[model samples]
Target chain A: MDSQITLSVNGTSRSLTVDSRTTLLDALRERLGVTEVKKGCDHGQCGSCTVLLDGRRELACLALAVARDGVEVVTADGLAHDGLHAVQQAFLDHDGYQCGYCTPGQVCSAVGMLEEVKDGHPSHVTTDLEADVELTDDEVRERMSGNLCRCGAYAGILAAVRQAAGA
Target chain B: MRALDYLRPESPAAAVAALVSNPNAKYLGGGTNLVDHLKLGIVSPDELVDISRLPLDDIQEYDDGGGPGLRVGANVRNSDLAAHPVVRSSFPLVARALLSGASGQIRNQATTAGNLLQRTRCVYFQDATTPCNKRVPGSGCSAREGYGRYNAILGASDACVATHPSDLAVALAALDATVVLLGPDGERRLPLAELHRLPGDLPNLDTTLGRSELITGIEIPFSPVAALSTYRKVRDRASYAFALVSVAAAVHLEHGAVRDVRIAWGGVAHKPWRAERAERALVGQQLEPDVIGAAVEEELENAASGDENAYKVTLVRNTTVHTLLQLAEGHR
Candidate 1:
């Protein structure tokens, strides 16, 4: 059976009929033709399907489409309204991606990562409980470890995140 | 994947009622683990009760007559739970263990209950074509005679040798946390230790949770030991990997002697292996290398290991002793 789901994507609401087995990844790519959300591994291992749901970054491939009815989804393509997001511009300025296959996911994850840092959410590397977590190299690397790059462009990625974070 | 039915239940009672009515129904939390299994044809539930919408995502501190305890909702994301101020201050071991598991993105999708009910990471069990007792009862155990370097060495039966792949469970077991479940009848509480069953013979069953039961939250009591706790994980990489052998240790030292202690190990057993024997041996004893060494030896006396997994025994011993020493050092 197919169910109708209304998804608030990038400030736009889209209603579509999808099967219960369809994941948010499938819905964005197959149903709505938003193919920017990569399907790497198709499993939950890779971070290629990362997206922001109500401002929280999550794996789109693992989230069921029906379960995400009426939630805001911000993918890499939707990150920038007019110009490129600061993180995206920083990626270009620093050559944060090589093959660019994983750039979209990395950008979305970094967007959400910055939001977490702004909200005072600490990472595993943050040792001092009394002080605010700084976006150091270790913290950025630990926070962005989910989005892996096959091209090994982590050095540039680190530079881009640091620039965008203004560290 | 099979065509599935989805039910969005707004209330916990409705969720349990939906599961109670359907014989083949599963509660979908964050879908980090279950969706993977569903895609691999590991499980095909006739109906999935979407409990993610329920309003159970609060982390609160309450005084239940005994002391100040924390109750974390089952739907609370792993990242949020780990970053909560109370959890970081009261149970840093839990926060560290949670952060050590999965990746930043996966933690955003994974929930508290899903982490506790995570399936084994054994390749045999994941590959549907292979024969695994935990995946298919009475089929056979493939890891027993196969490549089992990541398999269990403690509390493993011949039928199954797969380890529980949750670092959070190991810390929860050490904290003496209690799980709150809501069933068709009513709500009930069970200790996290008794929640996960050992693979004695029935490897098919994983937990003691009833078929229609929905996990509401977990309650962790306040203790001075948790303030001095730490989690040490030995893995293949620095992040995004299951533990090879990890230790979650909490201690209360008085005048340089171990007054109270708690220890739990992961990646070496069917369930979170609680080192009660070791804890008993260390209580009222000086924090010395020889004393911890003797306790580790006594705790691992009945451990049975396979050919490739014998290293886990030594790995577990070293990790446990190291964690104890670190906690003891912090005490001083």
Candidate 2:
């Protein structure tokens, strides 16, 4: 069955006919020509399709395009057009990427992670609830464990998130 | 790659209507498991019904605040349920088990009902080409003699050996939880202990759930047994891995004697096994080293293990005793 969805991509909004089964990742790349939403595992494992759904990081591959009809999807490219978001700048400064495959997801997830911290959402390592958010190495590790880096860019990603979070 | 039909039912009645008529329909919550299965072609639903909008997100009262525990909705996220004030105070075992479960992303996307109702993650079941009794009953279990070190021990038949993958269910079974079901007929609830069945007779049907029924909530009755409750998982890795042998144990001490004791093991059975015989053996007996050891030993006397799974017997035993003793000591 065909369903029409209107998604606000970056700044503009577009309406398109999409299959109910088509994932946001597929819709972004296939229909909208937004290739920035990479399809890594396509099963929510690799986190390559990480995007900000209404300003919160979510795996686009795991989300149905039909379910995201009215939601705003902010991808990695949404953060910066020419260069990068502050987090991405920190990543570039920290040499946070190797093959650059998982970098976009990492940056997008970090951007979300920082917001989560700012919103007082605690992680497993956030033992003291009364204290301000601490983006320690362990904190970043625990928070960013969702996105896997096959190229072993964890140290760089950690630095990137740490710098962005002002740890 | 298929264009599927989509329906968003705003109410539970509407959701049931969508489920009743469309045999090819799937009720989606969080889409953590179903979407992955859809991509893998393990389950092909021509119609996708979004049940996430239903009013099943609240955590209600279950066994009263004094004794019996709380009721969690099917739409409750694992992350939220784990961090809920009542959950964190009343049943840390559930929270601990959940926190140790899938990655934060998956947990945020996974719902309690979906997690409890999730099928086994056996490789064969995931691979459509492979033989899986759970996937296609009577097709034969490919993991019986295959890479089955992680399959199951108790209540597992030769037909199937897949284990229930929910970590919270183990703790819930130990706490004497109940599964509330809502269907076309009406709402009915089952003691969580009765939710799962042994794979001996019908390896296909894992739970006692009806086709049109939805697991509305899990009601955990509070018991003093788990004042020192804990979940110990021995997995392939420290994090982001399924357990090889895990034990959720609860013990109540009265006059320094083992009172109402409950034990359940995940990754060790087709269902979350409540060790009744073992619990009986432990009760009325002093929490002594020998008494506890003997009880644990008696439980595994009939435990059948293959070449690679024999270690699970020892692991379950040691882990059980250690958890019981630790909780027991906490009282002192």
CA lDDT of every candidate: 0.90, 0.80
How good is the docking of model 2, as DockQ? Answer: 0.46
Model 1 spans with C-alpha error above 4 angstroms: none
| Candidate 2 lDDT over residue span B213-286, tens digit each | 78878887766665566677778865677778777877778898877888888888888878888899988888
Q: Which stretches of candidate 2 lie over 4 Å from their true place?
A: A80-86, A114-136, B1-3, B62-68, B254-256, B284-290, B329-332
Per-residue C-alpha lDDT of model 1 across residues A41-153, encoded as one tens digit per residue? 98888798999999988899999999998989999889897899999999999999999988999999999999999988877777754368888899999999898898999
lDDT of 1 by residue, B201-308 (tens): 898888999999989999999899999887889999877889999999999999999999999999989899999999999999987888998998899999888789
The superposed Cα distance between candidate 2 and the true structure at residue B170, in angstroms, equals: 1.4
Give the 10-residue window scoring lowest on summed lDDT in candidate 1 chain B.
B323-332
Flag clash pairs in model 2.
Answer: B68-B222, B69-B222
True contacts kept of each: 0.76, 0.44
- Model number with the top lDDT: 1
